[model samples]
Target: MEEGLENFVPLIKRSRGYEELEKDVIDSGICSGCGACAAFCDRVGLTEDGSVPASECNMTLGAVKCNIDGICYDCCPHVSYSWGGLEDEVFGARREDELLGQYLKAFAVRSKDKEVLKNAQDGGAATSLLLAAVNEGFSDAAVVTGRDDSWSVDSTASKDKKEITGGAGTKYARAPGILKLGENLRKIPRLAIVGTGCQIAGTRRLEKKFLSSVPKAELTLIGLFCYENFPYTRLKEIIEDRLGLKMEDVTKTDITKGKLHVWTKDGKKHEKAVKEFADLAPESCVICRDFTATFSDITCGSIGSDEGWTTVIVRSQRGMDLLNAAKEKGYIEISDKVDLEAVKKTGGFKGKKRAKVLSEREKEGKFVPDYS
Candidate 1:
């Protein structure tokens, strides 16, 4: 090997950049496109198009700018992530429960507002939380997901009740939920990021690293319980081909009780075995180890609660304060009774499954990673 070229390949492999992320994770078909790299880094850009997916980090247009301090590398949760370390760092206490994580309160929660209830999935708890965060001034703008004219989902910084409500329903497709978070950093004093485990993991790293510049103390992170997210086109094929229903005709989608329940415009509900959509799940989701978004101040999902109610896990002091205020202000209601054990049972199963996959990958000598 030539003197100058001898260390080039190894150096590139070792250094962390968008290009590195592209080759190792994205091109390897493991990039979830959670938008953490795009949301926080100035040098990286993410696109949701199929042909030029977020997995494609275009180095021809933008080169590496992270070699100086490795700040961008630090922002990625996948490069190397330790859930237990982060939980202790963020919460200042070790998690006693393995699956459901640390929480001050657990509840089967529902929205008091009829509008949110009508539009949201699972009793509107996540949407209701975003609305309350905005109304209570805990957040000036929120990072949320909404659909376009073509019904494609994307992340946006929502500033008002209308925008928050517009992003209410679950699209059930994987989209970059925090792709544009940095754009609104200066515009909004306090910003709340709502996303799945992958996105929240990346956001948690970014929040911790960029506190001074981004007003770290003012930020709020809320997470969703995600077992698996599906590919859009494959999901459509399953819904339209097997179920014989047009994608547009389906009004809302929810996964509960081992079925994919799709509601339509005619006020009719269609159910399909979730196993039918198994092949449509992304390659990235297969090895992910987190089902509960344990890093966030608050995490909400439907797994642990009764039907039409969201399982709420208030994980931080800030989350507790916000939930209390929201309840007092007539935004959310706590369930009279909750199955606390149910959250643990479901979440533990998901965690165990993920751990097995991660262990298998390690045995196979493949790259085992989390997400950013």
Candidate 2:
């Protein structure tokens, strides 16, 4: 019996989960379901669905470390500021009308991956810019949106901030992952944040709230051209019940090649041709007045081109310098094209239409609608 007790003690000491949880800090936002151990030398692990098994994570007395540090628990953006915490260092700015004059600052960029272009909700420009910012130390971390594992259908990720690294291209889902900025601002001194029109507007508001204390050097905003985002519940219904695909089987989904393409493991490859899905664009998006992400230092999307590239509009001198430096460093290939004015015109037209519609509505006594 003593021999058996000694053997069990050694077994507990050999736990991988225990070691990682006790030693290594977990970054919930960057977890890709690559199941390694948590800490503690225990066997606690991540599932393919990106969730952790709570049963395996149960802690008991006699354990050297408490189980408060479970990776599964640590990995939740909803819980820990571990993924990306917002600190008091954030400075906010408000510049909605200013966004229009800054419209000319945007431009487009492209890559050959039809997959990358298509998977991106807009042009691949936002992802490229984020990569460039991190590479140049313009920011130590980037905040972008992705699908919430909990809410599979919502367009918003977490309505909180997330720290993303090694840009795997843009996550074109309908969720807001940048909402956590308030919690994470302390850990990250320099941050590059990406958001849609309304979110950026909200970010500007937040910036203003923190402006007195938060330094401008701590934050950079990149706004994506948002047309509309589908609600997650309805989207799930459409994809699963209507299209006959399981949610878990889906590896990726995005608007690409002028269509909404969905890839699933059920041996199904389907698409909503741009014609059909384009009209389904959210009404909130149509009514939104900001088309060029004017509030952002740089605005990126595919409003200008049908082919493979992101249209990046640089509104501030800082934005221009960043792009030029990226070119100098060879992180991006810069080419001056003649059609830039034309692209700006396209964005302007859309912005005008949106503003006109909103004005008409406001005159009739309506508040800015919140669709998400």
What TM-score would each prediction reach against the true structure? 0.85, 0.57
State the weakest 10-residue window (summed lDDT) of model 2: 82-91
Report the lDDT of model 1 for residue 221: 85
Model 2 segments more than 4 A misplaced: 1-106, 110-124, 147-172, 256-259, 265-269, 273-283, 338-365, 368-372
**What is the alpha-carbon lDDT of model 1 when measured against the actual structure?**
0.71
Worst 10 residues of 1 by lDDT: 4-13
lDDT of 2 by residue, 84-152 (tens): 122112213333333343433444455333444444544455665666677786877776554444334
Clashes of each: 0, 66
Q: Clashing residue pairs, candidate 1?
A: none
Please give the RMSD of candidate 2 to the true structure.
Answer: 14.5
